[model samples]
Target: MTLNCLAVDDEPLALGLVCAFIEKTPFLKLTGRFSSAVEALQGLHTQQVDVLFLDIQMPDLTGLELARVLEKSGAQGQGPRIIFTTAFNHFALEGFRVDALDYLLKPFNYEEFLRSATKALTYFELIHKAETPMVQQAPQTQPIREDYLFLKVEYQLIRVAYSDILYIEGLKDYVKVHLLNESKPLLSLTSLKALEEKLPAERFMRVHRSFIVNLEKIGAIARNNIQIGSAHVPIGDQYKDVFSDYVSRWT
Candidate 1:
């Protein structure tokens, strides 16, 4: 799905970079470019904007203030998916609280921009698909189970087999899928909770808020940590009893 994107920033250079990035991305369509939040809001009223690239700090009306206005106006799900762009790191938490699709720090490269855009693209696609009516109805059939899943990383979809995954680590808004044979972990713009829902419960268990380990990949269990190959994943205090029960059943 091509997102109708609108970019708003006071800095001409930042605006230019974002516009250029949007143009380069195949799934993104630049709907409008505004030098101020006020102009962007006007653009939003005049046309449809599926995604918004907004700067946090602006004169008169900041991006956060604009977002709050949109939220209060009941644009939480109907409005554009926001991706805040700023140089400050402190606004990251606030961005999430505002239900932003992603956060991009200033001076970010095209790669970083692509990651955030891809996330917005994925979200729009999912929402659109759910809203669209299914035309073809066939005979009832069981769902086909899969051993692998596709992950969007660096603008490319990488297939990762469930058997190859050693563990999964949640780092704020992103997740790292560690593989047994691979040295580099696969990174994607997604939450651990989202990933956990995608994975089979019988095979994967959440041992910590920041960790999910493959049942077959556990090598050793030390008091507070579980070893998955060379990686030692910590077991969160709240999850310890549940994990211990699971281990006891197997032992």
Candidate 2:
């Protein structure tokens, strides 16, 4: 199905660039464009936009803030999926926090855009298959799922299943990945931030600067620590609020 989509960016050039790119993609149809997210919210009431191209920062409502508002109001009626376009990288987690389907870092090329499009379609199909009779008429867009991810361990490429991973700890230059079936970690020379993008936000969360934990496994929790097996991961002060919402098993 051709995706009816909208674009919202303060920069006219950035907005125009996306419109030009959309003209070349057969599956995407540009339905509307807005410089302000507030206007886009108003447009949502009347237009049929299947996907949303959102900018990170704006005058009144930031893209991340707008996404949170949409999700809270459940405004994603027709799979008007969101893909955040941002200059800053720090808000990556916040993008996922609002369950953004994909994130396109600025200065991206057609290949990157194609990759994001494919991911969006994949999410749409998954939700389409799982929808109930009542809500099926509304857009059945699936959340993004990360299956197998790559990690370099020593001289070999280490493959880790999203479900198999328990948690990760970051050192100065290496990350130690603890798996469900293994005691020792599969080490990588990659940052926790880089690896965070490869996993589904719903399945995994960052509880600390040095630790990322899978929500499914929780042997225990004490104070600000998450327990998986015998290991304890400390929750960072900066991420405490976000992590607290998901650590309900312990709370």
**Against the true structure, what is each candidate's TM-score?**
0.56, 0.54
Tell me how far candidate 2 lies from the true structure as C-alpha RMSD in angstroms: 11.1
After superposition on all C-alphas, the RMSD of every candidate to the true structure, in Å, is 6.1, 11.1
Residues 104-214, candidate 1: write the lDDT tens digits. 998999999998998887776755553443322223365445687767564334668899999999999889999988899998878999999989999999999999999
What is the TM-score of candidate 1? 0.56
lDDT of 2 by residue, 1-251 (tens): 67888889999999998877777788888889999898888888897777899998998988887887887787854447788888888877687656577788998888888788776666565455545442644564764443767565542344578889889888866789999878688877677888887678988888888889988886887787878988888989999988767666455
- What is the Cα-based TM-score of model 2? 0.54
Which predicted model would earn the best lDDT? 1
Top TM-score prediction, candidate number? 1
Give candidate 2's total backbone clashes. 3
